[model samples]
Target: MIDEQDEFDEFSEAGEAEMDENKGLYEHVNITVDPKQEPLRIDKFLQNFRQNSSRNKISQTCRAGNVVVNGQIVKQNYRVKPGDQISLLLAHPPRLNVIVPQDIPVNIVYEDDDLVVVDKEPGMVVHPGFGNWDKTLVNALAFHFEKNGSKSDLDRVGLVHRIDKDTSGLLVIAKNEYALSFLAKQFFERKTRRLYWAFVWGNMKEDEGTITGHIGRHPKNRMQMHTYTDGSQGKHAVTHYKVLERFKYMTWVECKLETGRTHQIRAHFKHIGHTLFNDERYEGHTPLRGVNLPKYKQFIKNVFDILPRHALHAHTLGFIHPTTKQDLYFESSMPHDMADAVKKWRNYLEN
Candidate 1:
């Protein structure tokens, strides 16, 4: 029987071997589909495992005999059966430029030997990517850890979960491999607690409710995500939201995520006809604009100008400490812009 230490050693060796092979990214995961796992297309199944693999790339691999099911090449639409053996021969993705550590400042809300909880500011990308290749929270953490002789590699050092780039609030970073693995398991098992605050368009009729749907990439637009009803390709996502305050047109809401999908809160709210304020993609045009009241229209325009991104903040985070096994909770107040929006709306209502 393979013990935990042995398993870790094996993983380490495999990673080293892949590095030797000049593959920038490689992972071999073996999982048995649970009985609850609904039937999914083969390409979709493979896409879930490879985070950076595009759907087109997945399909091309399927056609090129890189994907095998039960030791035989299969089409993309092949239904994934439980207990079936699946193997993928994926080429390594192009290497990203080496990310140099930077001295970007971060708000450390709580810290211990095992982990650090940070109140990340809005407009700060968590990690390096695209146009945001430097001056990120990861770069700051790397610099800080280096000072203590605890630096980690590029793929992941302390990060376990991620909040959207524009979302402000509390986030946790693991200090070691044990903590990283434990926290990752918590996320996979849906055991962690995440809550958000958002100012959404329109007054909600219900005080509290849940939004359930399957989320996947937009069929035509590769950049955006959309709800899938045909079960063709998507993961089940759920969000529970309650109206905290209501104004003439907008509403302040507190949302809890039952399933954490990319853009889950933003997408789910939009799915329910209440796109978040300043959400350019989901809520394209401002309803309050062109109204007779010039003051209200100007207020709406100001809100948009001040906040250029989605009006969402990850206000609360609760999870078990990876190494200590102690329950940890962290919360952050809404950032200046969101607080200002709420204040102005309240003042408008009074007047």
Candidate 2:
């Protein structure tokens, strides 16, 4: 059954009206630098005012003529004078609802007037696609907007980016058109921070390293992806990983994405011979059998029975708020099954 947080009735219909007026709009903040302040950079000063706004956004605004220092547009690093009259024009974000909303239950972590951060569970598809038509996150968001009488247009509602159906983690959902556009831009420009935790087979030789490759659809298997060398139709993907812990036959790793790509972490690990544990497609039973150790064999069998899905979870996400421009970060612990597997594996090693 779908669970929901208590309704926040503090907002009346009038409040919604007020929010509409402010949505996708920016307010100006003028600050006078103190001489003792040592002349902070323009971008830094603006960031102080817009707490959640990304540095890239501030830079973009300044470069686009939206920000004027002493009535003149300047580069992001321009030092602010003590009495500089900094004027900033905030633009409303474009509408983001391209798909129809369904009543999907999203585990909302944080919410405000402009956006929402949801902890999406595994097996929940973000958007509608082939083989799955309904009960998606978009559908649930549509129901939410409808219930509030904020029937957003199909082309512009709440979605910013998406996580794969089997990958669970924090996802940002925009509440209005302007916030949606702003957040989308941040993700597109790779200004947001996303960290994931996963259990993979084998110990990594290095503590941390970056994987760079061009990823594209598999030539033989249309449903799968492969690292492309010719770079004909693929985009550049980069994944950075740090070894967090190690087991006799497995390693717990933390991964950060410099560029978001389809199956990025999974594919990259597979490329490096450290495919995620219980990943059916990449690291199958052959690798497990290769160990030829009875205890290890029993552990693999037990793990497979209990953990049927990929051993990956989005552990942390951080980004600048689109409206208030404040820095925000959220984290989720590994699920019970993953934790259990780790514990059991470690105990086996100790014994």
* lDDT agreement with native, every candidate: 0.68, 0.67
Summarize candidate 1's per-residue lDDT along 1-351 as a digit string, tens digits.
Answer: 111111111111211111111112223344455566678998898788666777765776566455567778788899888677776644332244666778778998887777788999888877665566678887888787777676455444456666766778988877654455456546645688878999888879999998888877667864456776565766777789888989868888999877766577777777778888887756534754434554777778777776777888989989987556688888899898888877877786787
lDDT (C-alpha) at residue 21 in model 2: 11
Kindly list the per-residue Cα lDDT of model 2 for residues 1-351, writing each as its tens digit.
111221111111211111111223233445555655668788888788677776666766665455667767777789887667666654333234356556667787887777778887777766544545557766676677667775454343455566667677887877655565566556655678889998888878998899888766667864456677557756677889999998857889999888766677777888778888877756543344467555777677887766677888889888888767799999988877788888888777787
lDDT of 1: 0.68
RMSD of each: 12.3, 13.2
Scored by lDDT, model 2 comes in at 0.67
Q: Model 2, residue 322: what's the lDDT?
A: 74
TM-score of each: 0.71, 0.69
Error of 2 at 107 (Å): 1.4
Residue 241 CA displacement from its true place in model 1, Å: 0.9
The stretch of ten residues in a row with the least summed lDDT in candidate 1 is 1-10
